[model samples]
Target: MTDPVDLFVIGGGVNGAGIARDAAGRGLSVILCEKDDLAQGTSSRSGKLVHGGLRYLEYYEFRLVREALIEREVLLNAAPHIIWPMRFVLPHSPDDRPAWLVRLGLFFYDHLGGRRKLPGTRTLDLRRDPEGAPIKDAYSKGFEYSDCWVDDARLVVLNAVDAAARGAEVLTRTACVSARRDGGLWRIEMRDGATGAMRTVTARALVNAAGPWVTDIIGRVTGTNSARNVRLVKGSHLIVQKFWDGPQAYLVQNTDKRVIFINPYEDDKALIGTTDIPYDGAPEKVVADEDEIAYLLAAVNRYFKVQLRSDDVLESFSGVRPLYDDGQGNPSAVTRDYVFDLDTGGGGEGGDGAPLLNVFGGKITTFRKLAEHALDRLGGRFPAMGNAWTSGAPLPGGDLPGADVPAFLNTLRTEYPWLPRKLAGHYTRLYGTRTREILGNAADLGDLGRQFGPLLFEAEAKFLRRTEWATCAEDVLRRRTKHALHMTKAERAAFADWFDNAAASHRREAAS
Candidate 1:
C-alpha cells in the first residue's frame, strides 16, 4: 500500500486552490481534485472586484468588510499583473441612501482595513467630474472610492500552478466519487472526467471547498451530515460594448437598495451585473434569465444618461453563491462571511478518526485569509507544518519587480520591440514575468505561429496548453484567456476545429 498523503482537497475553485497552495507550501503532501475546470463555477462568475463589500455595512457585517478591505491591497501586492487598483464612482441617490449615510459607510470602508496603498474616499461632483458624464444630470452628488479588479479564473489557475510547483498534485476534470474513513484515514476514490480512469488515495485530512456544491459533496459524495447548510443565491452579469469613457467604473444603486456595477472590461467592452435572488436549481445550470438581464439594464438606465437595452448585451453569465445560511429571509441579506465546520472524526468518539474540514461561504477577496484560517483549523493535526507564508509570496507570473505593472510593461515593450503595442500590453498584463516563455526565440510576430484572431497566436495557445493545463479550445478561449470575446463566430469555430485536429494528431504521435 502507498503512503497516506497529508491533505486531500475536493474542488478547484479559488478557495480550494488557495487551500492546496497553502498546504503544499507548508510542507504537507496534498492532492486536490476538481470535478471540472478551475474556477468554472461561482469563483469566475463573480463581480470580479476585491473590495470591502460596502453594502454589507448596512447589514452590520463589519468583520467580513474589514477583512475583505485589507485583502484588496494584499492581493494587489501579491499579483500586480492580474490585480490592480480601480476607482469606483458611486452616484448618490437621495431616494436610496442619504448622502450622510453613504459618507459614513465609505468612512468605515476606508479605515476598517488599515488601507495604505489604495487611495481613500473623496466626494465627487457628478455634474462636474468626468466620471459623472454618463450619469444622469439629476445626480449632482457622488462618492468615489478605490477597489481592485481581478481576473478571477486566472487567479484560481495561478494558485493551482503555485501549488503544483510546491509539490502538490492538482487534478482537474476529476471527480471524487466516494470518500470513506478507514482506520483513521480518508480513502478517496476519484474518476477522471475525460478518460473514465479511476484512482484511489488515502489522506489524513480532507477539505471540501466545493463552493455551491459544498452540501452535495458532504451529503452525496462523503455521505456525512453537517449541521450547517449553504444558501443558494443566484447572481448574474452582462457583457456589453463599452458605453462610458475613462477607466473608472460606476456603482449605481437600485430601488431595492441593491447595487449594480458597470465596470470597463477587455478595453473595449463593459461588464455590468449582479442581481441577488434565491435560487433552487442546479449550480451548473445557472444562467442569466431574461428577467435578470432586463433588471440589470433597467438599473443601469435608471441612473446613467446613456440607456442600455437587451440587444446591447453581447454575453451573459450567472452563478449561485453558496452562502452560509444564517436564516436571512432575503437572499441579499445573507452573510458573505465564511464558516468552517471541522469534523474531527468520522462519526467516532474523541479524536479516533480522520479529520474532515468543510468550508462554507467565502468571497474572492478573502480567499488567501480563508486558506490561512483553514490551515489554522488543522493545526492540531499537522503540528510540524510550516507557518503561514502566502501573504508575502507571489503567485506564478506575478513576481514583477516592486509589484509595478506599468514599469514592467515598459520593459516588455523595450525587449519585444517588434511586438505591437497592444499585443505587448496584453502579454504583459496577462503573463507578467512569464511572457518570455511564450515569446521565446521569436524575433517578430510571424514566429508566434498562426494568428487565430487579434492578439491571440498559436504560440500563446501552445504555451497555455503546455503550462496552464489547458485541454480544450473552450479552456483557452473562455477561461485561460478572453479571446472568444474578440474573435468572430466563424473565427472561433475555425480555431476550435484546428485545435481539435492538432491535439488529436499530437496524442496519436505520442502514443506511437
Candidate 2:
C-alpha cells in the first residue's frame, strides 16, 4: 500500500489552487484534482476587478471590504504584469444614491485597507472633466476612485504552476468520484475524463473548494452532508466594441438601484456586466438572457451619451456564484465572505482521524488570505508544517525588478529588438520575466515557427502545452491566453485544426 499524502484538494478554481499552493509551500505533500480546465468555472468569468466592494460597505460588510481592499495592493505587488491599478469613474445619480452617501462610501473605501500605492478618490465635474465626456450633460458630478484589474484566468494557472513547482501534483481534467474515510485516512478515487482510467490515493485530509459544485461535491462525491448551502447567483457580462475613450472605466447607477460597469477590454472592446439573479439551472449552463442584456444596455444608455443596441454585443458569458447561503432573500445581498467547515470524523483532540475542510463563498481578491486562513485552520493536524510565506513570495514569472512592469518591458524590447512592437508588448505583459522561455533561441519571426493568427505563434502554443498543461486548442486560445478574441472565426477554426493534428502527433511520438 502506498503511503498517504498530507492533503487532497478537489476543484481547480482560485480557492482550490490557492490552497494547494499554500499547503505545498508549507512543506505539505498535496494533490489537487480538477474536473475541468483550470478557472473554466467562475474564476475566469469574474468582473475582473480587485477592488474593495464599495457597494458592500452599504450593507455594512466592513470586514469583507477592508480585507479585499488590502488584498488589492498585495496582489498588485505580487504580479504587476497581470495585475495593475485602474481608476473607476462613478457618475453620480442623485435619484439612486445621494452624493454625500457616495462620498462617505468612497472615504471608507480609500482609508479602510491601509491603502498606499493606489490614489484616493477625487470628485469630478461631469460638465468639464474629460472622464465625464461620455456621460450625458444632465449629470454634472462624478467621482473617480482607484481599483486594480486582473487577468483572472491566468491567476489560477499561475497558482497551479507554482504549486506544481513546489512538488504538489496538479491533475487537470480529472474528477474525484468518491472519497471514503478508511483507517483514519481518506481513500479518494479519481477518474481521468479523457481516458476511462481510475486511480486511488490515500490522504490524511480533504479540502472541498469546488466553487459552484461545493454542495454537490460534499453530498455526491465525498458522501457527506453539510448544514451550510451554496446559493447559486448568476452574473453575466457582455463584450462590445469600446464606445468611450480614455483608459478609465465608467460605473453608472440604474433605476433598480443596481450599478453597471462599462470597462475597457482587449484594447479595442468594452466589457459591460452583471445582473444578480437567483439561479437554479446547472452552473455550467448559465448564460445571459435577453432581459439581462437589455437591462445592461439600458443602464449604459441612460448614463452615457452614446446609445448601444443588442447588435453591438460581440460576445457574452456568464458564471454562477456559489455564495454561502446567509438566509438572504436578495441574491445581491449575499455575502462574498468565505466560511470553512471542518469535520474531524467525530474525533476529539489528539485522536486518530482524518479531517475534511469544506470551503464556501470566496472571491479572487481574497484568495491568498483565504488560503493562509485555511492552512492556519489545519495547523493543529500538521504540527511540523512551515510557517506562512506566500504574502512576500512571487508566483511563477512575477519576479520583476521592484515589481516595475514598464522597466521590464523596456528591457525586453532592448533584448528582443527583432520582435514586432505589438508582439513584444503582448509577451512582456503576459509572461513578465519568463518571456525568454517562449522566445528561447529564436533570432527572428521565422524561427518562432508557424503563425496561426496575428499574435498567435507556434512557439507560444508549444510553450503552453509543454509547461502550462494545455491539452486542447480552447485551453490555449481561451484560458491560457486571449488569442481567440483577436483571431477571426475562420482563423480560429484553422488554428484549432492545426493544434489538434500537432497534439495527436506529439502524443503518438510519446507512446512510442
Instruction: Write down the worst ten-residue block by lDDT for model 2.
Output: 344-353
User: How displaced is residue 235 in candidate 1, in Å?
Assistant: 0.4
Model 1 TM-score, 2 decimals: 0.98
TM-score for all models, in order of appearance: 0.98, 0.99
Off by over 4 Å in 1: 346-350
- lDDT tens digits by residue: candidate 1, 1-512: 46899999999999999999999999999999999988889988998888889999999999899999888889999999999899999999999889999999999999999999999999999889998898999999999999999999999999999999999998989999999999889999999998899999999999999999999999898888899999999999999999988999989999999999999999999999899999999999999999999999999999988888998999999989999999999998999999999887645324657989999998999999999999998988888999999999998889999998889888988888898989988988888899999998899999999999998999999998878888789989998899999999999998998888888887798899
Q: Candidate 1 — worst ten consecutive residues by lDDT sum?
A: 344-353
lDDT values, one for every candidate: 0.92, 0.92
lDDT of 2 by residue, 1-512 (tens): 46899999999999999999999999999999999999999999999888788889978999999999988899998888889899999999889999999999999999999999999999999999999998999999999999988889999999999999999999999999999999889999999998869998999999999999999999998888788888999999999999888999988889988888888988999999889999999998999999999999999999989999999999999999999999999888899999998878766434567889999999999999999999998888899999999999988879999999888888887888899988987887788888999998889999899998999999999999988889899999988899998999999999899889999999999999
What TM-score does candidate 2 reach?
Answer: 0.99
- Model 1 lDDT, residue 59, Cα: 99
